[model samples]
Each structure stands twice: as structure tokens, then as C-alpha cells.
Target: MNKIVQIDPDQVEDVGPLYAARKKVYPQKVSGTFRRIKWGLMAFCLGIYYFLPFVRWNRGLAAPDQAVLIDLPNSRFYFFFIELWPQEVYYFTGLLILAAITLFLMNSVGGRIWCGYLCPQTVWTDLFYAVERLVEGDRRERMKKDASAHRWTLERISEFVLKHSIWLMIAWWTGGAWVLYFTDAPTLVKELVTFQAPAIAYIWIAILTATTYLLAGFMREQVCVYMCPWPRIQAALTDEWALNVTYRYDRGEKRMSVKKANDLRALGQHAGDCVDCYQCVAVCPVGIDIRNGPQLDCIQCGLCIDACDNVMKKINRPTRLIGYDNDINIQRRIEGKAPIYRIVRPRTIIYAALIALVGGIMLYTLATRSLLDINVLHDRNPVAVKLSDGSIRNAYTVRFLNKRGFDRVVAIDIDGPQDAKLHVVGGDSITPDRPMIVLGRDGTTELRVLVTAPSDRNPEKSIPVKFRVTDIGLGEVASATDNFVAP
Candidate 1:
């Protein structure tokens, strides 16, 4: 039998708060292969974003000349040579799928490569940090300034103002560049400067500006840790084989000073290379100690690797105390075996294959897509009408899409019951039985059409009716099928 004992109320310990206040992180600047790579990528990304709007593509007269534009008013999306109508929204869907698969493939090979190297947040935040470092000084200087009791000195005030001003300018330009993609870039720029641009454009610019300033300038790593869903997603997607910014504990355990490590090694005792300098933590953008093992907060940006490598070089130890490595390699090193890498594994292969397949399909469809199209909608109120001449008639609204750069004449014809007479309400026939209509350049035109069948030939049940529109000059053809019903 067990005896039940009652605990005193005072003996119970108080529980700690569930949430902790955010600590300000001041990431130090470091330079290495990864840092150079990041700088190159940031420049490339920003250059394309800020300047691509000004690039022009010759799409004939009366068409948008901007290389990339989202002509929302005209319900069109243009990218260099490709033009997409609203009906081709599936292309966007395919693009989204391709992006997701590429991200997965990157994650499967190297953990959070997108978050580390190419994420807009990471790039912008890095830029903001650079501005901060330039204005306020490096990690130690900034920390000393912030920690001082006299927080409002003249020099400090000037630094704060300068840093924030630069940040705001960058944010504003980022917003401005986004709006340029929606219209004629040079015209919009002039209108914007003259204060004659549309209110909606200014409103969007303001919204984006505020968000970019807040997220990149102040939120910084908090955006990566608590806000972005990709970190959590990549955490789940990462595998043991994936290379992450990791500390090789096998070589860096038993942290001690360089002098002590040297003495131990000389005495024929084991001494790990790590010196516990905290440089890795100092240079981390997310303020995580990679030595503490993989955490969700670690973006795997590899700055810590640079810091550790620098330290190792100074201490006369082998570099890469922290490097792009996996748990499997760490274990293999501990077991006195050579490290192995598997970049071409099953998951990565699958992701690559899927991306290729989707990309191929989209390219093929775009290349072979029809320039002319038609859609037919049957009249609802009266499905069929009985004419005075003992004939059955069906009315339809036919919409013709001419996706060409110039106006074209198209002849329309209908095929249904034998001896069917086709008539366009406001159009004249270029031929005896086919009505011809002029289609505007890269536009849609709708017409009311009537198809009449003789009473003797009219079907008792609804039958299929096909409408064909043929371009008179190019001989391009498009067709739509509806139904012909008896009165």
C-alpha cells in the first residue's frame, strides 16, 4: 500500500515565466569565402531589383516596352519576350511550384541555404547591419555606446541619426523600385518626382517602406527566429547528411586557453583546438553559438565558420573548427574514419527531377501556346428561339482574344446542324456565309452571334455547336464549342 502525502503550499516553487524578453543582438563583421559570396549575392539581387524596371524590350508599338511589367489594368503580365494573359495564370502556379521544389532541394543538400544566402530578409538585414557598422562602429563600439550610462551624447546622437537616415532611405528606395514594376518606369519616376503619380502607387510605396524599415532595421534576427515560417519548415526538412554550419565537437571539445591546450598537447595529453573565444557567437547574425549544436535559430549562414577559421589560423591550429558539415561527419571523425558527403541523394534527385519536369512543361506550353483564342457562352434567358420561318435559333456571346501586336481581321463561322445559317449582330461577312470582324492589337472583343438551323434539320435534343475564328492575314485559327438546343 502507498501512503499519500500532502505537500505544504509554501514548499512549492514558483514557475518561471513562459516568455523571455528579447535581448538586443549586435552581430560583428567578419570576412571569408562565405561573406564574400553573400556580398556578391546581395549586390546582384539588389541591382536586378532596383534597375530591371528601367530595362526595355521592343514589343512593337502600343505594347508595354518595359522588360518586366505587371500590366494589371490590361490584365496582362509581361516578362521580356513572354506575355501572359489572365487565362494563363497556371504559369504563375507552375512557377510557385518550381520555386518550392528548388528550395526543398537546396535544403536537402545544405540546410537553410535560401535563408542564409538568398532570402530578401537576410540580404536587407545584412545591408542594414553594414550601414549600422559604418555609422556606429563595429560590435564592441556599438555595444559600448549602447551600454553607456550617458546615452544621449552629441556624437552618439549624430551616429544614431545618420544610421537611421540611411536605413530609411534604403527602405524607401526598395518600396519605390517595387512600384516601378507595375507601370512605365521612366514615366512613373518623373510623375512620382513631380507629385503627379497615382495615389494608390504612393500608398503602396508607403506601406512597403514602413514594413521594410521595421523588419530590416529593428526586428532583424527576430524576424528570422519568431516570424518567418521557413526556419521551422527547413528544420523539419533537414537531414543528417545535409551540410549545416556546425562545430566539430570531436576536434573542439574540452575548451581551454591556447597556452593550456599547447601545454597539454606537449605533455602527450589530448587537447581540443577550441579556445572558447566566443568569436563564432560574436559574428553570428542570429546571435547563436554554433558550438551549442544545431538550433532552430541558426540560419546556417556560415559567418561563424569564418570567425572560427580566423581564430584557428591565429592560434596555429587547423582551420574549420566550425564549418559546413553534418552530424554524420562529426561522428565519423570521432570514430577515426574519413568523412563522406552525399549531395546526390534520393530526395535531392527527386527534387531536381521535379523541377526539370515542371520547367520543361512550362517552356513547351509557352512556346506552343496559341496567339488567338475564343470563348463562347450560350444565352441563358432563352436557350433556343423559334423563328417565324420555321427555324430554330441559338444565341451565344463569343469573345475573341487576339494576342498579337497589331490589329487583325478574323472571319467567323459556325458548324452545327446541316444548313445552319450564322449571323453576327453588328458584323459584315467578308465571304458569303462567314462574318468578318476586326480585332484590336493584343485585346479581346466580344460579339453576339446567332446560329439558325432549319426546322426539318433541327435535332430533338441538344447538340454540339462549334465556332471557328480564322485570322485573315496570318491564317491563325481558334475555336470554341457550345451547345445548340431545339425550341
Candidate 2:
């Protein structure tokens, strides 16, 4: 891969204002099985994200007590049972790949499940809606209250204040919870309250707070419809067989009043189950009519299913005119054939296999990962130096990471040269010149070393030399190889 070195690693410019003005989104409050599931997931996700950093796991006396931590200062990631240094960043890359693949799999089977349920935007937006309903009222009441002005009497003022205050409180808490993941949570909380936290911490809190409030409280459904890219990609990825919150227009259409439909059915004319109550549209958070034939704006949250079911129950008709279904299945039903569902289609199978492969690889690697790490850099500019006695020498910068919680002795040696002398600067060369080096607990140390080969021992013009680091305490060995150049 040709690296875009000029691209700033942390900077991606926002696509400039595509729309002249932001459209207001007043997501109607919904109650149904899907809404309840969304609420449960929201609470669970937020609970874990906000409080997990406070949970502790002991890793002897050397590691941080936090269960999950991203220590930017020390360049370490600590989970409940795993500690990762900079060298282990590849594991994170692997995880991201797995996560992306899982998202694709979810899209193939169910269509943007992440967007509908697990995405932070959706969760937070749902939370904001709940708060709004509690403080103000349901959709009709809220819309009515907004329409009238002096209706913003003292009571309205109090309710509005209470609502915004709660929204901001949640936003603030969300921001506060985020910073806890980076440091010791209990101590950081105290420091933050006393205003002793770092400037960067405060800056990050402000950024998160503003974003959470705006995105969840103000932007709401517009974020899903316009701001998020998933809907557009989901539209592209979806097929005829993928189950989505679909309106079975085959049954729901020829729409008319219950009395009118009953009259037509009695007369032996075409009639359908729908009562034309518009409950389905009213309950939709995204506010798109599923009867409009699966528009991009529909989140498929399944609130319509609940509303239609309720309507069906009240009117003594069949439920689920709008349900989790697919075009192919609808066609089959229309043709008087049994509807078929293939959850194990090629797309879904590929995605599941990839997920399994990546998950297995990650599990295996995590189970058997080495506790020690080593890195080597050969000195440049003067690749080789001719010693006084005519032995050719190469200098190397060696770094060793001791992941264990106790100090240990390590023996550094060279393996490729038959008569080469190894010197660990500031180290003991005792008992057959076994260069002794010490590593601190859960820390890294760098040392300069000189490897010299006698003129007669130079096997080739450029000989590959293997540098071996062996932990005396555990017999664990790691090696790096580089070419030794001859003058």
C-alpha cells in the first residue's frame, strides 16, 4: 500500500455544508416491542459505556486497576484480562475488521440492524425522545404545545426548562463517562469535580457534551435520514430476499374504512384488512409511511407493526399488515404459494464465515500471545565500523518490553556469527561473556549494542545476524534478524 504520508493521521475534513439549512426533526414517541427492545439495548449500551471504566480487575500491583483503559500518555490499552502495548495495536486493527464484517452480515440478513438498534446515535436519540415524552407529553401534545405560543405559560416554561435541563444533564454525564475510560475513574471523577483534571480532558468533555446534546436532543431523526451514510449503503446492499419492515401492500392496499371494507367484503368485491387509521405512520420515529413501498427514510424500527397490531386488535381484523417481510416472500404469498425465507443465503453465509474466522483468529491469538516483546533498529549513516584490531562491527538499537509484573534478567546474544563478540553497553559480560541485561516490571528499556565479527569470520559480503533476547526467569526467547555489512 502506498501510504498517503501527507494526509494528517487524525484529520478528515468534514464535507462542507451540503444543505442550506438543517431540517428540524421531531421524532414521534413510539411504544411497541421494537421500541421496548431499543430501550433495553440503549440502557445496556449506555450502562456499559458509562460505567465499565469504574469496574476494576487486578493485574498484580504493576497494572492499572481500571477494567478498561486507553492510556494515551503511556501508549497502552488495558482490558479486564488483557494489557496491550503499542506493538499489539494489530489486534485492534483485527477487531475493527471483524466489527465491519459483522455489520455487513447484519445488513445482509436484517437490513441496518446497527442503525436501527445498536448505533450510538439511535440509542441516544431514543433516550432523548423518552425524556421529551416524559417531560412534555406524547407526539400530539408536543406538536400542539409547539403550535400554540402563550401555551408556553408558566407551566410550559417549567416543563421546557425541566426537559432541556435533563437533556443537558444526560449530555454532561455522557461526556463525563467518556473521559473515565482514559484514566482511573474514581480518582478522575474527584479530580474533575475539583477542576483539577487536565486541560485536554476538559476540552474533550466539552466537545462530547455539545455533540451529544445536539445530535441526540436537537438533530434526532435527521441524523439517521441525512447525516448517516448507512441508510444509503443499506439501500444499495439490500436484495429482494432481505427481510425489512415492509408494508404488505398486497393485503394493506385497496385501503378504506373498516365499515367500507366490511361492506365491500359482504358484496364480494375486493377489500383489505386496513382501517386507514394512520396509527402506523404516527408511531414511526423516522415518520415515513411503510405503505410508501420501503422508502430510504424508514428505519424499520418495527413500531408500525405494533401500531398496526393494536389497530387490528381493536377493529377485529388480522395483524401485521406491516411486518418483517421481503419482496420475494410477498410475491410468493400473492401467488398463493408458501412464503420461503432463506437466512443462509450466499451473502449471509460469506459474512458469517468471515465473522467466525476473524473471531476464532482473535481468540486463538489472545489465548497464546507472548508476554514479552522485542524490537531492533540498525544504526545508519555509518553502517559498519572497523575496530582497532580489524574486527568489523555493526551497532544496533535494541528495545525490550517486559510485560510481566516483576523485574527480570535477560541474556542478550548473537547467533549468526561463529566468532562474533556481543557487548550490551552498560551491562555485565560475565561467565563466557553472557551479556546480562535487566528489565523493569511492565516497562520497556532500550540499549545500544555492538556486534563484532573477526575479519576471518566474515562468511559473506552481507551476512544476516540474528539477535536473540532470552528471559532468564522464564526461558522465553524472541529474536530479530538484520544483515551485518562488511567494509
Best by lDDT: 1
Model 1 lDDT tens row, 26-110: 9999999899999999999999999999999999997889999999999999999999999999999999999999999999998
Candidate 1, lDDT over the whole model: 0.92
Off by over 4 Å in 2: 1-30, 428-432
- The lDDT per prediction is 0.92, 0.85
RMSD (Cα, Å) for all candidates, in order, is: 2.7, 8.2
Residues 74-190 of candidate 2 have per-residue lDDT tens digits of 898998888888888889999999988988888888886788889898888888888998999888888888889568699899998999999999999999899898889999999
TM-score of each: 0.97, 0.92
lDDT at 202, model 2: 90
Clash number for candidate 1: 0
